[model samples]
Target chain A: MDWTALVLSLKLAGATTLVLLPIGVILGRVLAFHDFRGKRWVEAAITLPLVLPPTVLGYYLLIALGVASPIGQAWQALTGDTLVFSFSGLLIASVVFNLPFAIQPLQRAFEGVGQDLRHAAWVGGLSTFATFRKVELPLAWPGLLSAAVLTFTHTLGEFGVVLMVGGAIPGETRTIAVSIYDRVQAFDTAAAGIMSAFLLISAFIAIAVVYGVGARAVRLRG
Target chain B: MGWAHARCGSVAEAGPGGAGEGLAVRLRQAGPIPLSVDLACAPGQLHALVGPSGAGKTTVLKAIAGLYRPQAGHITCGPAVWFDSAAGAWLPPQDRRVGMVFQSYALFPHMSAQANVETSLAHSARTERAARALALLTQVGLADKAHRRPADLSGGEQQRVAVARALARSPGVLLLDEPFAAVDRRTRRRLQQDLAELRSSLRIPILLVTHDLDEASALADQMSVLHEGQILQTGTPEEVMRRPASERVAEILDLSPGV
Candidate 1:
């Protein structure tokens, strides 16, 4: 099968997961624990990607990172390389499209770590920061793991967004999903079939891991 | 079961090195369990706030512990001003050096019993924390289960661990918000006995909030009756039971006049 495409997909997913991990955790925690005016609006905006069509999202992202846009112009000036049709542009697109996949699990997990535990920690002479590190983080570890795995798995299978923003450039932005589509267009059904099976199995295993962690957390919470 | 001496349990008797005198509070709020309270508990005295569910009993305890801030209040604990709304002086919960046993126990499920207690020893030396935590656990009769997480412990054991953690910091004031409400009757009795025994060693005022009047009379040196967020009466449980001051106080206590 297309090994380079496979490798590129893994690398991109890995980078996206690494970047999303801290953002998801902070956003998730703030959303879970804090009350603020317009919180519902903030929550709705975060969950928008879950409902937004991928191609529609990709089209917006394409214009946002196009040569004429501010972000696109700045990137070219700073890096001397245009963002459109580049792996960096694809990575940014993947991050935006995959926000729900990274954040929802973490928010749910943080919410599960009860307010009583946090209050108890604080009254036990632990600061808010200390309580988070010592109590909330440990309790929400399963959610964090699930968030990472989901983000990685979802990014690896990203197709429309990557294709829209990065095109199908070999070795630069052609992920396994894009490669499979290219193979199918060339009538390379055998290669497409193999890659699709691999993606499907890996996605299944990733989801199974998330479910397993959630179940274990629930049992432990008992 | 022999709670005869427990009624007067160690009263701290103005004795040498008795529980330190602290915990003076006045609070006023309009909603969310609206509270109007003016109360004080001396060193070594267990003051129980007896009330119905919406009487703001837990909120009173939380206010003393610096966990909840009322619209206006002041709390003084052993020469330290924990909160003063007029002055805009509010100590965060961590700095209050207050021990609080939540109704739910609220133990860190991920930490072992010893570690849970050890978390309160943040101010103590690192190497000494384990032994100190063990000592506290042993005091609560959970020495053998130090390595077990909260999930492995029984409800009673978890509550005991929460107590041990609260005591680890040698707090200036202790707050118990229906700490025994979740356990079995037998366990609750045992926990009450444990608190009575441990009360002698603590040099801090304790504020207990409970809906159970019997529990209040059995444990509190002085009890305050709260209704609709207002502390209607404060006296020794015996005094309150015998003379409820108002018809409303008698009704709240389920006591008939002259009974």
Candidate 2:
């Protein structure tokens, strides 16, 4: 079974989830409450990953972070390492691909918190940050948990975006999904089946935790 | 009773210059209506804003609380200028030192009554927070229900918790939007009496928004009759009830032709 690939996949998903959670929360709050011109366009752009082909997103990131680009050149100059075909590149690719999975649930959770509770907290003399921490975070924990789980599972199952950006480098970017495809190409049916089953079981457990345990926790709190 | 006396003493110590200067609001327009109101409530006094459901009464309270900004106006509570459109000074709700109880009470559903009250005592020391919150809940007659969440409390109990939470900071002004609209008649009467006693103890201005004429007449020291976002009449409740400025005001008050 590709244990190296399995470990790499978990590492990538863990890193991506850790990075995406805060970004998702901040962006979700903005989307949930604040109104500004072009907000709809911004939302559409954020959600584009949910519908757009993963390779298309990967292709854009490839050009944007490639050695020829200014960002890539600056990154290379600063770190003496290129972004393309690196674990860092794969992590960014996974985050972008899983952006909607991280943000949508969080945004819904914040919206569900409603303006009344926020207003109450404000009038109660709590600062904005305090209110978000005391009231919003507690109330929106279930949705946040769901968002985190979805981001983690989605990153673990990433195939097209990682394939496009990371290019199946062994022990570095060859995630489980990529390894499964490589196993099939190599006519290694047993290895492919093992990896696929592992991914399927992980997805099921993550989803069960979110729907079964998370919902019950929220209900019990109420 | 001890809590009330303690609060009065604290208020006096906070401002020795007598009851702190009251809340004054002058707004050209607020909310969706072309609202314009120039009203004031003296310290230690309860001013009721009486109007129909959509007559901008709650909007006036929100503007004073710094929750809603008027297009052209200033709200001055005590010595602080909460909003001044021309000077571009606007204090957000958190900085305004204003406590507001919505019609629905709007308590934090997940928190117990004590936690809800403690949240308002942000300036209190962490060690003193629980005691202070408990004292305030006792003042509102909810000391026993301090550990109960809003969902578990009755409407009157929840309202008392909201009142306790609002009073936790000794706010410069208190705004109540249809405070008794949700309670039963007996509970409403008791809450009204409790509020009246509370008003006597609190030196800061109190603004009560309600559509019920009886509520305004019973509790308010000064009453303003609003119609279509305009103050149609402003006077003592008895004066307003006895002799409305116009037929419209009388009709809105539901006063009989002779009375």
Candidate 3:
């Protein structure tokens, strides 16, 4: 097992999950409650990265951040460095790929919080933010937590996006997925098998903890 | 000192249900439509609105509570303009000092019984909120259940918590929506007596909406019969029953010559 690549994968997954959690909450609540033009289109757009070909996504990302595109130039000017072929770039790619995993469950959960509860809150003189914090958030906590866990695991397993954009740079963007790919490509089946075993065990442990906590919360609520 | 004393004397001398003494809610929503009703509950009296389901009885209550925006009408409670569609003056529910006990008992299921009651107090100190809530629970005979959740309580217990919550604000007008319907028969009778006692102690006009005439007669000092979104008659229960303003009122009252 490549310890550095393993640590890098963990860090990337952790960072992606942390960044996506608040964004997922906002997106889920908006999609669940708000009525607006182009909402369906907006939802489709958010989900597109999940289904889009990873190579095509990587190509677009590569081009957009290659210092030729206006966005890339602007970003370079702001950060004094290019985002392409970096750890940060891989993190961004993983978040985009796993967004739907973080959002769909939460949106469904929030939608299930019936309008009667919200109407009662309105009559009670609660402001919109207060109602969300006090009513919607508590009701949707289980699904939101599950979404977070799912996105984290999905990000950890992400290979195609990281491979194309991250370029498998050793110790910088060489996540465990890319490291395993490297071992396979080099015909080192033993190392590849070890990495695969670690990934499987870690993914299983993460999912088990998530479901365990979610089940406990549901039981308590009942 | 003399003029002030004289003024106080004249104010006190006015008879019960005198001009500007009780709530007057006459509201119209939209179009040429008009939804109007009038009542003068004497101090320390229970007034009731009895009607079949979907008679717009809840509308009338909501209008008075400032939850409804009427097209045209005025609601005056005592000297205050709760809602005057003509004058365009409206007071919010919180400002009106009106306590409402909802039909579903709308107890905050998340909070304990005491906290639910304490919600009525705007400026209640943390220490006093619990004490005052407990006192109200005791008055409603649920002091021992103050720490219990509404879900843990029986239907009757939930209703008592609702009543205690309504009284927590010391409202000038208490609106009860089928307050006794949820409780079992034994609890209902006990609650009825407790409500009557509460009415006397609070000395506030009570407006209760119910479909049951027996319950209305048992509790109301004044009764209004409504049918199909209109008031058929308003009078003392005996008078309304005996000399109904319309045939519908008579039918609704189920009045008989002997009774």
The per-model lDDT (C-alpha) reads 0.87, 0.86, 0.77
Residue B32 in candidate 3, Cα distance off native in Å: 15
| lDDT, candidate 2, B149-182, per-residue tens | 8888999998999898888877999999988889
B122-150 per-residue lDDT for model 3 (tens digits): 44666787788899899888989999988
Ranking by lDDT: 1, 2, 3
TM-score (chain A only) for the predictions, listed in order: 0.98, 0.96, 0.92
Q: Which sections of candidate 1 miss by over 4 Å? A: B1-20, B255-259
lDDT per residue as tens, model 1, A20-62 = 9999999999999899999999889889888888888889999
Model 1 Cα interface RMS deviation (Å): 0.9
In order of appearance, the predictions have TM-scores of 0.92, 0.89, 0.74
DockQ in order:
0.72, 0.53, 0.15
lDDT of 1 at B135: 97
Cα lDDT, model 2, residue A166: 93
Runs with alpha carbons beyond 4 Å of true place in candidate 2: A217-221, B1-20, B30-33, B241-259
Query: Which pairs of residues clash in candidate 1, taking residues 3 or more apart in a chain or in different chains?
Result: B19-B203, B20-B203
Per-residue lDDT of candidate 3, residues A1-222 (tens digit): 889998999899899999998989999988998889999998998888888988888888788767797866887899887777788778777878888988987898788675544543434444467668776787788788889888888877888888887898888899999999999999999999999998898889878987897787656444
Model 3's CAPRI class is: incorrect
